[model samples]
Target: MNRSERRACRRLRVAGAGVAALLALSACSSSDSDSSAQLDSPASASAPDKLSGITVFAAASLKETFTTLGEQFEKEHPDTKVTFSFGGSDALAASITGGAPADVFASASPKTMKVVTDGGAAYGAPATFARNELEIATLPDNPDKIASLKDLTKSDLKVVLCDRAAPCGSATEKALDTARLKLTPASYEEDAKTALTKVVLKEADAAVVYKTDVKAAGDKVEGVDFPESAVAISGYPIALLKKSQNTVAAEAFIALVQSPAGQKILSRAGFLKP
Candidate 1:
């Protein structure tokens, strides 16, 4: 080959090699840029893995429904655990105000919930999630033939009612007042479950308690709905405690209780919608 032709071919080959090197360098630079960008991006960050435990102080009437919801919350958040303290709403409120460590408070009545709010123990305004009506819970087959509220007033019939301080008792009182009838219970129980237990254990012929408790008793007790119950429905309220250490988890639980899924569970447990 002639010198000029050979020189031109060598130059062309050199130029081709340089172009290949530049392309390779560009690709490497682009890849490095992408890696850096991803590292700096918030969207590429991993989710938090911290464990969260929440303590909930709920009313006796909410035991079944809240327990079901707590189980679901734990299942949805594998890193979370829910602990419950269930009892009379007024008592629970007193505990919270007395410096009990709790993340949430679910009360059976607005009056009890107000105890916490008025004490400034709540993080925010409480939300009413459910309502409960009064019912007469009697032994299986209702041997006492307790078909109405007045049946409880009949002499010689052993009847039990919640304490006036309790939400269930307060509701029962309102119901009796609505019917223009007065009742003298054999005893005043501390909570609805305790009141209902009187009939379940056959300790008393009948007990005025929340319908939810009666339903929860299954075949253990028969529920008698009175027309007066409409006027005595108790509103259930829930709120995050001001002293909550795990606010995130507590808020999530509150959201669950107010969600459609949670409402369905409460409804299935015989609780009314707020």
Candidate 2:
């Protein structure tokens, strides 16, 4: 009776041990499979690093040109993505000064670039890539017959000009002062492009804006060259930001903008190369 009972108890204990070992191994196998699955998944395998994304804050007038350049830059650097926030140069400068995470800053004027440089937001000395002059833009039909700067002084003409806070506005003021003409615009726009838009939309009879902006408007408006515009020339500046995380990419993009291809794009868009 003692031998049979002892043997049966030992056999039962051995069988229980085997089952426990199998269960442990099965759990380990399940965990390994899960890890393998995770590694093989497309999302985990192709996830991009945060540094691959770059943000640029540029002037509103550069919207078309920079957008084209951004697309080309992304194509050249497949792993990196370029994003932009285009606005008035003053506003863009203000954002960078206020600690916005911008990798690059391309301004429509040196005056605005100085705002960022003064704040120590630029990584290097800004480079002038292009020059622009002010033009009197009107509707395609020129219904109000805005022909020259002096015509802007007409009380009946609804003229639009950039705000005094913006580079275009400041340039306009300088040009007016040079021409000895005083203009009280119907509205002081936030940016050159906005002022141009007002005239293009037929909301205003005329606006003082960049020649590049007038060209950008295509058939929406007709541009009229004025002698006073010679007094004020806006210089476009490009620079890398000090707080940029992707310095390599930022430098590469800056180089691209200075390249011949970039110059062609800018030229075709009506920007005068410096």
For residue 243, model 1's alpha carbon misses the true position, in angstroms, by 1.1
Query: lDDT score, residue 219, model 1?
Result: 95
Best by lDDT, which number?
A: 1
lDDT of 2 by residue, 1-274 (tens): 6999999999999999999999999999999999899654323432245568778898888899989999999999998999999889999999899999888899988989999999988866899988888888988977777788898899888999999988889899999999998888899999988898887678888898988899988889998898988879889999988767776687788888899999999999888888
- For candidate 1, the per-residue lDDT at 79 reads 88
Q: When superposed on Cα atoms, how far off is each prediction in RMSD? A: 12.7, 10.7
After superposition, candidate 1 runs with Cα above 4 Å error = 1-51
Residue runs of model 2 more than 4 Å from their true location after superposition: 1-50
Model 1 has a clash total of 0
lDDT of each: 0.89, 0.87
